[model samples]
Target chain A: MKNNFYRAVYCSRCELIGSPETITAELQSILATSRRNNRPAGLTGALLFANNCFAQTLEGEREAVERCFERIQIDPRHSDVTVLEFGPAVERDFTEWSMAFVGDPSATSPDPLAVALFKDIFADNHADSGAKVLLLLRQLVHQEDLWAIA
Target chain B: MNQISSQPPIQTDDQNIARSVIRTTTSDQAAALRESFLVIEDGAILLDARLRVMLCNIPATIRLGHYGAPPSRGYPLTKLIAHSSALDADARTTVLDRCSAMSASDLAGIEARLVFGDIVIRIRRLALGRLLLWVPASRAAGESSLHDPLTGLGNRRVFQAALAAIFTKPNASAALLMIDLDRFKQVNDTLGHPVGDALLRLVGQRLRACLSQEDVVVRLGGDEFAVLLQHLDGVDALGKRLIDLLSRPYLVEGHLANIGASIGIAVAPSDAHDPSTLMRHADLALYDAKAAGRHCIRFFKSELNARAQARLALETDLRRATALNQFALYYQPLVDIASGRVTEFEALLRWQHPSRGIVSPAEFIPLAEELGLIVPIGEWVLRHACRTAATWPADVRVAVNVSPMQFSDSKRLICAVADALTTSGLPGSRLEIEITESVLMHNNAETLETLHALRALGVSIAMDDFGTGYSSLSQLRSFPFDKVKIDRSFVSQIDGKGGSGREVVRAIAALGSNLGMTVTVEGIETDAQADFVETSGGHQMQGYLISHPVPSDMVSALFSPQSPIASAPNPEPVAPAGSRRLRGHDHEK
Candidate 1:
């Protein structure tokens, strides 16, 4: 695909209604399924799981991206599904990570964007939520690498 | 001549052929330069015009693998280096453009920098493609910029990196100590920056000596040092030792300079796990230590954050209160002992916070002073008091407390006072400026001159909260005053038993009389307290026993001779649970 292709970036947070192992199992399966389903569809994104919540950002062709979110919204493994941000972008922020995963069981450190999004979607006193979410996901990806190594 | 011309032409032709041969050799040498870059310490990656990694040296491959997965030949450079979040959207765009179709003139000599943790990658366009050199961020400082120049201790950046490393180590529990030097500014002001610098070096050395070999000491800029302790049993004994060692007097450039250290500690895994949050919590604890009177130590507790948030909320509210004109002055009648009548009304600050109803001045004044909001707030209080007291009887003076910060700039204070008096048309005699002994402790000749000038303007000055601080006697002798208010501490202790409190009160009153100054005894909350003040030769009595501070509208009624409450013989309850009397505005430090 050409680099100038338009894509939709969407982030949602939902409560993980299962044990840490079960969540981990479900996440691994999701990653397996996503990489399989997204490679031909030209989709790329990242998934971050801290505490008992899941924050995922999806970027792809607008229709394909929306279709993927539809499956996630109906998934029984999670509850309290709420979309934090949805918008059209010039390019994909997570082009390299087709399905990067971050799962921190002792995730006591607060994520500024996650807190704001969960509390109120429109209560972003900071103007640029999309950029902040992108950076936050990127940080989570780095942290996930560290967690894997540990 | 013909033969020479033929030789010159032949030489010219040979010279041209030699130049062409030299050019071919130089081109061959240019192709060999690529392999020579492999030995450099920095990571090197050479790319083709199509943006594929053509060559990745050993260091570059290691760094790429460190970030994520290493790239092989023909792999995209962007994908290989996309693991770091610090290279945000703009950097990504520039990297791609410089590799592809960006004009040579656009990016001609400029190199794009991508910072990933401690590694800084410099990307510049080569003749055919792009070259990226990844060097350690500290290379600009010759590889060891982690230590502070003045103290030879690690700088803040090193401390932060160490904190991060601790968090990554499994089962590692450490304590972060944030220590700040107290009265260091005074040393600098009195001695000089060179002396101050020497004192800092001495403090750093002492801190180092107090720590174990495993502990990392960092000079976090300007009298603030942070220590990370590992494999420690408890931080209490170490904290005590640090305080003692840091508080000792230091010989700096032949001058003995004294400074104290306040430490705030946060234990890892309990208080916080992350470096920034841990540092912040320790800093909050440091603030608490400073608040609890310097030269102390405090450990981080969950409640500290809530208290800090509460303070932040109050600070925001105070700024709004000033803007909305929500502050008012209450007048406590300073009455004559013999006449049983109000002589002066001490104007006390009262903040009508929108929701909290009445926020105590004791709670907000120091905060305001710290926030640098006191000057404007003080100006408002002075003008409001002068304007309100202008309506009162001319004989009843109005006393307004002035903070030391306000007096720092004597010109501004003088102008404010002059403006208030001039605009209100209130005689300077009816305006009294109440100042504590600490205000005069600076002993600045200019401050004394400012005081004398204020006195010369016919305005009365009272030595407020007297006998509560050092140099009370010396201040009384050095500065001219129209009145002296015995601090509430001594008055609260006075009774018929007559101990040091009564003796001290008697001596102060006698001294005030001897100097031809009116003496006002404060905190007289009972009949016995009032009687003690009268018998002890007090000229005026100011306390709840006389009259609780009433708002401006009630001032006229209190000062009226016909009003029975003004001179009530049996005073009401001194301090009801919710009475304003309990919210006395005491100076904090």
Candidate 2:
């Protein structure tokens, strides 16, 4: 039997406390660590930080994806972590990047689109919000050339 | 204040700020230092030289509230300790005196450790006249180790503790309820874990809503919960209410999920005095509730325990009986209606326990199935029956009954059949495999593939105990069975009253014949039943009216060339009653 490919999306309240610069540094370190870990595990995904919330999607073999998600759930920097979607998928949407990050944490003003999408995710308590997050991530990654593909 | 700044700075970055805040004694610097402490996961509180609260984080405020001494900026530490309901008067005075008497040297390390009920608070001195107090996150979150994170209910540890506490008081009247959710696995498998988790949380909320605060409810594990009821007066009503409430549909994560609860109740000091015994009794009753069907409740009884003990002994005997070769197969003849000749014999397993004599298949077959011994036993029956039938006339086929468990692994079953045929040197055409509708209910594709493979080997398939299970007609339409055996229930219902039972039998026989399948009416204990079956278009009849299932050695004697049954094509039907005592006659004995 072929290995089942899965994608999981979750949003959590960002518990990291500090000035914007400190939080930006923390987010950059998170992106770097995720890239280093995800490549060896055959995982590819994107992370978004805006409005004091973090939404991320991980896509890989089912077991690897679930293991990475479990680790993220226990990380002290995130709380109220809610999984939006977790199931077998036909194909990977973020295949080019091991960990693609979409938000400028150091910027004085948060990205309006990312912040709006995060607001909608928190406001809507339905399963479709996970799909909406995936669509938003796919669109943001395609629209912006600033994100590093590592 | 300037004296603190002149001293050597702490090695850690955050601690350096702690030293500076104490030296400068500036409100702005203190606020920045408090902002840095927010990054720490533990609850943090800063105290001034007078041991008054200066700054606190959100976690610290929450923890303080839990200890019944909510903190505020500028609040005196002694007053906070005095206000705590968690601490007795002596503990409060001890904590206050310890804090007030701390020397400048003592402020450089952990100054005081205070226990308030289950919560512990640790005080550390950051600098001269500056102390930091905080609670570790693990111990601070309402003692999270004793709670289930998803539902906010107590965990198994809490259940054990509560049970132990109840038993500590002699003559305490309490009831334990073991609840298991039905169809929960289906939802988890189909909807994914998020929805399943959400459903569990909703179930927890509903359970809490049904009972009073005095009753303790805990999520024991996945889809299993336990409730400790202090009052036993309305325990039955509460169980019923729980069943009704849990059975209601739940909308979880945009999906509508339906599930049910089965509860088993055991009361303390009456059913059992010890925690382990009470738990076992509740679990046994839970098994009974589940076996009785979902959404039901059962109470512990002494007879249930006796029955459980008996079953354990029987299971042990069955395991040994299989190894000791204590099982035998009795053959029952199926007579052709038109020619009144025995064309086939169905193989039936009988267990002869050493001391118990003959054990009914009705009692042991289910146990064997549950124990997963049916596969090997079923194979043995096939091989043995084929070996016996190899000596019979070439045209008389032998039928062997197959349990649904045997079909779980189609490859093993097919291999067993092929092996039996090859080893016995019996032709596949001389063997028939009998199965019930349950064999086709699950893994339909695999079962069908196995059936086709068996047919390829030239063995016929028969649907046994037909019209008993649901969707018998649909099952017949799904596959082209060579024979359909009408269950004995309808045959026994034929009292010559021309009721629906007679009509049902006639309709099934007609339906079977119309489908080009042979119909065999079983359990015909009288002439009337046999006559009804013959006139109802049944092709074959097998029942007590012909003869009781006889040993393998006696099967051939009944149909030998010299016997009256073999010489006469339409011989007299065997006596319906007391046929077991009429063993002298060679034919129809």
Question: Could you give the DockQ of candidate 2?
Answer: 0.02
Error of 2 at B406 (Å): 2.0
> What is the two-chain DockQ of model 1?
0.01
Runs of candidate 1 exceeding 4 Å displacement? A1-150, B1-145, B168-172, B212-214, B230-234, B560-589
Candidate 2: what lDDT?
A: 0.75
TM-score of chain B of each: 0.70, 0.69
Tens digit of per-residue lDDT, candidate 2, span A106-127: 6677777767766766776545
Q: Residue-wise lDDT of candidate 2 within B1-55, one digit each (tens)?
A: 2322222233424333333332312233233344344555556666666887655
Q: Which residue ranges in model 2 land beyond 4 Å of their true spot? A: A1-150, B1-153, B168-171, B182-201, B251-259, B291-294, B560-589
The best candidate in terms of lDDT: 2
- Give candidate 1's TM-score: 0.57
Residue B387 local lDDT, model 1: 93
lDDT of 2 at A102: 79
What's the distance in Å from true for residue B373, model 2?
A: 2.2
Task: Write out the backbone clash pairs for model 1.
Answer: none
